[model samples]
Target: MSHMPTNIPDQSQIWNGPAGRAWVEAQSVLDDMFSGIAEYLTAQTRALGARQVLDVGCGAGATTMQIANVTERCVGVDVSEPLITLAQQRAVLADSPARFILDDAQVHDFENGAYDLIVSRFGVMFFNDPVAAFENLRRATRPGGALRLVVWRSATENAFLTTAERAVEHMLPDLSRRKDGAVGPFAFAEPGAISRMLERACWSRVRFEPVDFTASFVLEALELYMTRLGAVGLVYAELEPRLQAALVECLRQAYAPYTIDGRIRFTAACWVICADAEA
Candidate 1:
């Protein structure tokens, strides 16, 4: 039996559909772009020395496998079946001890007090009711168990993200602002608001530290980025061929400032949030 909530329909649809599939297809490029921050988050999780670990929103199972190397037990949970399928295949190929489950962490019925640590990388931002979601996670962790997750600080703080958005906005003009800002990548951008949500969810010793790292990605040109990396591909999909070409040009120019040594390198700002389950 599984406990999956019905409140997060939007997220379920997006993560299980084309958006999720895109991530699966470009896992290598995306991983390269986020490699530095991902390493930092996984290292922090390993430092916790938790025997039982739960990786929430463990996309493609990279962090899950990394932590599994050091932990006695580890499980990765995600909403996207396609991504989970890839994760499982990789785990099998590597003979990794980590288990990957296809389920939404927000409502999945994890055994009470089962995990000694919970971690995420660029996850935990899409919950419709974030407080409720964290409460669910709280119930799954043992008392005093630690949580260490990394999330983008803001869309404006991320040049790689905003460059593409701005490029498309130059072409489509009307696509500048998202109708629901609280649903996408920047959902947890507001530190104060997220802090309040965690406090209301009964987490203790909550701390947020801002970390900025320069991420470098191998790319022959910015067109590769526009077509292969991030949600910009979705935006490109919505365009006519001519307009897509135009957006590509716009992105190339926008990305020029970040290009060095024939690679795209930009500073990404993120928050490393740490909290403890209430005893």
Candidate 2:
């Protein structure tokens, strides 16, 4: 359950986007989210080993720096210029050889197997054309290399976000109608859409596993996080302030049931798909 890579009508419109300012306003929550994400990538890298790793959406380079610590080469790609700028700054502090690229879009240019391992945290779901996008990612991997990623599962399984959304639907206009933002949660929300896409892109032995990770939401802090970044943030910006406050209140109550021992307990399920190139 995340926002899409926005392709605004013009460059001048970039800063005006709802999610554009989310990075700064929601830094604390994002920091917490990235902490858990870094742990996930660290485990994945230990399994994949220290090699070439490409982070598809390296927001602020938290996980990217972690991968760079172990891998020989790391490149972070993001659509947000502001975020990329921050990532570069952080890279300087970490002293990691990670390069960041800012592009309005991602395309089908695997560049004929240029990477060894490709990774994304909660990225990859919002691409313009996922089949073409995965095909390009397949092209980027060296033969026998791997692709690893995590994405939101269906609403039935992720009540943490779904319940929040349902509670606030009337407060804000339906963001689902935005035509541009990828549909909520898993864009490939269907059962086998992931493996099918990979197979079509020349990947083999694709596998999907359930990802059950807990997320915490400190109501005051998380409210800032939810309405400030990416698509969800943008939707919050579109609403009237009074409605937005009411909406956040609704979420507070909705999410209260999940809080355990002072920490929120929300679990996400994803198909941790892995595949090797044809050897």
lDDT of 1 by residue, 169-190 (tens): 6567766453223566777788
Alpha-carbon RMSD of each model: 3.2, 4.6
| Local accuracy of candidate 2 as per-residue lDDT tens digits, 84-154 | 88889888877778888776325534367778888887767656556667777777788888888776677
Residue 181 alpha-carbon offset, candidate 1, angstroms: 6.0
| TM-score winner | 1
The deviation in Å at residue 45 for candidate 2 is: 1.9
- The collision pairs in model 1 are none
Q: Please give the distance, in angstroms, between residue 44's alpha carbon in candidate 1 and its true position after superposition.
A: 1.6
Question: Model 1 off-target regions past 4 Å?
Answer: 1-9, 176-181, 221-224, 228-231
Worst 10 residues of 2 by lDDT: 176-185
Clashes of each: 0, 0
How many clashing pairs does model 2 include? 0
What alpha-carbon RMSD in Å does predicted model 1 have with respect to the real structure? 3.2
